[model samples]
Target: MKNVLILGANGQIARIVAKRLLSEQADVQLTLYLRKSHRVDDLVAINSARVRTVDADIHDQEALDKAVQGQDIVFISNVDHDPDNELTQGVITAMIKNDVKRVIASNVLGIYGEVPGEYGRWNTEMLTQAGLNRARRSDELLEKSGLDYTTLRLPWLNDRDEVKYSITHKGESYVGVSGSRQSMADVVVKMIADPTYLNRESIGLADPDTQGLTRPVY
Candidate 1:
């Protein structure tokens, strides 16, 4: 049974990933880490022996240390506003101290300006430029952390339930405009179950059928 720790358990993607893990891997153990305990009351209400919730700030050394201990994989999903990459560093430090070696993290596309055409231009111009740069630095830290890691660069996210997606490597340009959160969650589970493409590579994910400047044709 694999032990999994989700750092940002309250977010939509993390919540979906947790459910998928529970449904797909019955023997797996889950540790959901969140800042607010009440945010995941529904998860706790499940009352399964395999599910555990930890309430702590991801940057708190003692708390993070306790969370990562005895975990086989650490999934980082920081939705909080971190412009300095501090949260990413904290996760790495805790993982190192706990001897946990595998990580799968969510990042934004165009960190390297790999998304081509007008779509790339629109995303770069209208989105959080500062946040993109900060995420790039965070990605750099993960690359040099000496631990097995996979960074997923995501496009504009929607809450659709579709699971279709396409992948592109670090240097390769992005394929489509929008990707569903469900597809991203599915990819995270895939990385956890099989680390065949691990080791600090950045992957861009998009729904193959969706193409436009923004989502919902607006």
Candidate 2:
């Protein structure tokens, strides 16, 4: 069975990923790591044999290490908020220590100033330089950390039920200013199911129909 560890399990996208994995992938086991374990208690109770929950801060080295052990893939479902990139660095350290090589992390777009046109300007104004810098540093850490990684640079998100989306590589201009949370979760599930799908690549995600909008659909 493929073992998957999902950090920040309480996040909206993370929760969707968890449910999809449980329902769709019979051969996978999961360790849901989050600050408040109770947030995923329903999953644990329903899928007791395949699901385990860890309740601890991401900065807690001991708990983090315990969660990382014996997992085949680590899914970082939350964005890095620490200016120093300590959270991302901590995850990298734990994964290296445990010899787990594959990771899929969530990040924001425009980190490389890749968004285009009026949307780009509006996105920049919305996210600000400081936030983008922190996200950029996190992605840089993963790229250099020697672990197999795929970073999803997401656009403004919505709760739309549809799964329509597209991908663009790191240097390509980010397209479609807004995408659904379901679309992002779908990408995560795809990566988890097939490890080599987007190996070592940082890609941007968006809904094709949402392109050219001056602002997010939401």
Which candidate leads in TM-score? Answer: 2
> Which tens-of-lDDT digit does each residue in 1-218 have in candidate 1?
79999988998899998888887877679999988878887876664688888998888879999999999988887732487778888888988998999998878888898877777777778666786788788888889999888888888888876888899898887888887889999989888777665556878889878655543221
Question: How does model 2 fare in lDDT?
Answer: 0.93
Question: lDDT tens string, model 2, 1-218?
Answer: 99999999989999999999999999999999998799889888768999988889988998999999999999998899798998899999999999999999999999999998898888778888899999999999999999999999999999988999999998998879899999999999999999999999999999989888888997
- Model 2, residue pairs in steric clash: none
The residue pairs that clash in candidate 1, if any, are none
TM-score: model 1 vs. ground truth? 0.92
TM-score for each model: 0.92, 0.98
Q: What ranges in model 2 sit over 4 Å off? A: none
Alpha-carbon lDDT, every model: 0.82, 0.93
Model 2, residue 217: C-alpha shift (Å): 0.6
